[model samples]
Target: MTRSVALFATCLGDQLWPEVVEATVAVLERAGCRVTFDPAQTCCAQPAFNSGYHDEAKAVARAFVEVFERADAVVAPSGSCTAMVHRYPELFRDEPDWRARAEAVAHKAFELSAFLVRELGVVDLGARLSARVAWHDACHALRELGVHDEPRRLLRAVAGLELVELRTGESCCGFGGTFAVKFPELSTAMLDHKLSGLDDRVDVLSAVDSSCLMQMRGRLQRQGSRVRAMHLAEILASR
Candidate 1:
């Protein structure tokens, strides 16, 4: 049976990182999975939820549940957004109707890396990118989602890739949605620590969420660092 998968490319990825979405589809197809893009998919409402707009978040969440209700699985390029979809149902625990919808959506969503490794079971996907690399663990992906190793597993499986450990591998880059705007000093301080860990040892930095990579790239560019930031999907699509 062909495993049908829905690609839930988040807003940033849809708007900016089309390559990531393309790579995500490429990897899944190469693994013999039938992937479809749900063009109606929107922001997973993480920004609204994190900003305390629960009602607006629920509207978006409900839309997603209704849209992808019949697909075999919903896969996303972002751990943060996927976690939001997976966990957003609990936000409406008091409302039985909305709560049920949230639970349905969450149960089907999967991070691209996690799905690639665990569900597809295809390692050594013929990816080839020769660069020293480090991974950033977004707050939602690390703490909320508990998805720490899948990306590394897939990265290591890439034929010509070298995955290096960041000095503080699990530290948050402080781009907690609005955290950077709310507390710029603390945000940069945290990112500075993350950037300092590079130490001429890596050529590229990758993460599941493009937001984190963009944030890191902004800081690295300001400091004139040559390290390139890429999404996990883009890296995996390498040949």
Candidate 2:
């Protein structure tokens, strides 16, 4: 049976980097899943939720559940946003009916790498990127989704791609949504700490979440580092 998966292009994926969304679809299709997208999608409301606005976050999450509950499975390029979906049930924990719906929908959500590797049981999509790449673990993807090896496994399968450990691979990139805006100095300090670990051998620093890439990319560009920050989907979608 062909898997029908919906792509949740979170706000960043939609406006900031549509290419990541496109790349995600390309990779999913190559892995034999029929992908669908709903234009009704919007922010997963992580910002409001993280800031402790449950009522506001609940309002947004209700719409998100409405849009995606019917999908047989949901896949997104971002582990952070996918992690937000995992919170819907908790966001509505007081209401059993909404919680039930949220639980059902959240159960279907999957991060791209995890879905590609664990759900589909397929690897080696014939992706070829001749570069020394190191994977950066997006905070929510690592601590929330437990997605440590799936991305590495997929990257290792790519032809001519060398997967290396990013010394600060597990540390937060400090792009906690609005966290950076409110604490610019602290965010930069954390970003500096994360970047300090990237050595000269790496050609690209890959990560599942574009937000983290954007955080690192800004710093990398400002400092004139040659190591390109790329979304893992973009790297995997390469031929």
What lDDT would each prediction earn against the true structure?
A: 0.85, 0.93
Query: Model 2 scores what on Cα lDDT?
Result: 0.93
lDDT of 1 by residue, 1-239 (tens): 57899888888899988888898999888878898887888788889898998889888878878777778899988888988887766877888987887787788888887887777777768899998888888777777777788888889988768898888778888788888899999999999988877768789999988889888998989988889999988888899
List per-candidate RMSD values in Å.
1.3, 0.9
Instruction: Give candidate 2 regions above 4 Å deviation.
Output: none
Which residue pairs come into collision in candidate 1?
Answer: none
Task: List candidate 1 segments past 4 Å from native.
Answer: none
The TM-score values for the models, in the order shown, are: 0.96, 0.98
Output the number of the lDDT-best candidate: 2
